[model samples]
Target: MYPILFSFGSIHFYSYGLMIAIGILVAYYLAEKKIKANGIDPKRLEWLVFSILAGGFAGSKILYWITRIPDIGTDPTIFTNLGDGWVVYGGIIGGLVAGWFYCQNHGMNFWKTFDMVIPEVALAQGFGRIGCFLAGCCYGVETHAWYAVVFPEESLAPAGISLFPSQLVMSAYDFGLYFFLEWFSKKKKFNGEVGAAYLIAYSFGRFVIEFFRGDMIRGVVNGLSTSQYIAIATFIAGIAIIVIGRKRFSQSNK
Candidate 1:
């Protein structure tokens, strides 16, 4: 894994950080295209991206700090150490909350914007998983599968051994989701369908992927990871959205 990108005399870029920036940029580009197609103001999309970054970063750090306490201080000399802070689920929650608020204030169609963003989220997740692959974190159990990836000696792990490359697995699933959402959006009979499908697809993906994660994360009360809980909740929310949207459509047709 190429965890360390490169170093100047005193500066270095990590693969994880660089990949996340790229993902955000890609999301912005998609948003621009979507805004023009949907007849929304593209400027509002820029504000949405800004809010996503600010809130996602803050929430990711907060969850990471809470979990890494005692070993890593709230204030540390080196922030975002390779194994230190970052929880992907936290970033999702934060991004959703912040994006909703931004859309509301700007008088954008919140559900419609979410529909616009479903494909972008999949694309971002696809690339972000690549970052995890390069960073050697969020890896999985050892495997002899043809797809297995072994890290270099300097890498750290819960067991400090070469293991399954879960990050790549997730990236593959996300890319598939990107295609699915994109195609489904084109065929959607009404608004909110794309966004609903995203919640359903991503939730199912996370539910299965958690099994391969070698590391133990903060689980909800019943020993399910935070992501599993979120997945279940998101799935329910997706169902609710579909039901409500369909009901409204039927009523309007009356």
Candidate 2:
């Protein structure tokens, strides 16, 4: 794995940060195209995307800290060490919440906006996982499989051990999900259906992938990782959104 892509005389360019920036730009391009097609004011896209990113970052960091409460109690400096640790679920939730508020404030249709944005979120996540793989974070358990990867000494993962490539798997899944959701959005019966589908699909996929994860910073409870528990709740919420949305749509038509 290559954490530092390159170093200029006194400055180092990090692969993780680079990939994240790439993801954001790509996602924004796609989202802007979609919003313009859907009759949304393209001018609003910047502030909307900014709000979601800001909220997602805050939420991810806050959840990471929450999971490390015991460690934080032992050493409070962890709170100020902002460069490491993030939770994807927290980012998803926070981004959605922030997007909802933005939509409401701007008199935009929240569900329609959510449907348009979620696919790009998946696309961004796919790229982010690539960053995780390059940085050797969110690595998988040791394995002797043909596809196993070994990080370099400088990477975050343990060096000299062949481990399952969970990050790549997750990245592939996210990319696939992005394609599927993009297609599904066209055929969705209700405004929130696409977003709900994203929630359901991503939660199930994440829950399964968590078993392959080797990192312990994410926390474990009752034989399952914290993410798995959140996945269950997110799955349920997705189902509820679909059911309620359909019901409301039917009632309005009636």
Candidate 3:
């Protein structure tokens, strides 16, 4: 994998960073279209994006630190490597909390805005996984499958070893999820229904994907990865939100 896409003089262009930037821009473009369609001001969506970036970055870093506590105990300098080690689940949680607060402050319908925003989030995540693949991070376990990939020297995964293309797999899944959410949103009857569906679908998908992950950077506790636990909680929360929303809507129609 080409981590350093190119370098001009002292400036280095990283494939991972580039892909993430492109993803954010594309997601913002799509979100702006949805915002205008929903009769909401684009300025508010901009503010929400700001909140997501700030909070998501912090949350992802914190979770990463937590996962590396074991290593940090041995090498205190591990804490200083702030350029890497982020957990996507943490970012999602942080972004959700921050977005909810932004909506409350601006008098926007949290669930409605969330429903519109999540599809874009999934789309962006799909692109981000492409970055992961390019950087050779978030790799999959070794396998003899015909579809397995082999990383070159200087790559993140074990060099010269055949491994599952887990990053690409997740990226494809995220893209499919974005389309599904976008289509499902039109048929949703409640404000939170679309967002809830995203939670359930994504959490379940991640839970399954974790089984193929080769990296141990994502901490494990009690025989399950930290993400697995988070996924279970979020999945249940999603189901609860859907059930409550449906019941509330039903009651309102009576």
Q: For model 1, how does the per-residue alpha-carbon lDDT over 95-204 read when each residue is reduced to its tens digit?
A: 88898898888887777888888698889988999998888778787777777777875444544465788899899999999989989988876688888998888899
Sort every candidate by lDDT, greatest first.
2, 3, 1
Listed per candidate, the RMSD to the true structure in angstroms reads: 2.8, 1.1, 1.1
* CA-lDDT, candidates in order: 0.79, 0.93, 0.91
Error (Å) of candidate 1 at residue 218 is 3.7
| Separate clash counts for every candidate | 1, 0, 0
lDDT tens digits, residue span 25-126, model 2: 999999999989988888899999999999899889888888889898788987888666889998998888898999999999999899998999999999
lDDT of 3 by residue, 163-200 (tens): 99999999999999999999999899999999999999
Worst 10 residues of 3 by lDDT: 75-84
Q: Judged by lDDT against the true structure, how good is candidate 3? A: 0.91
**Could you tell which candidate, 1 or 2, scores higher by lDDT?**
2
Q: What is the total number of backbone clashes in candidate 3?
A: 0
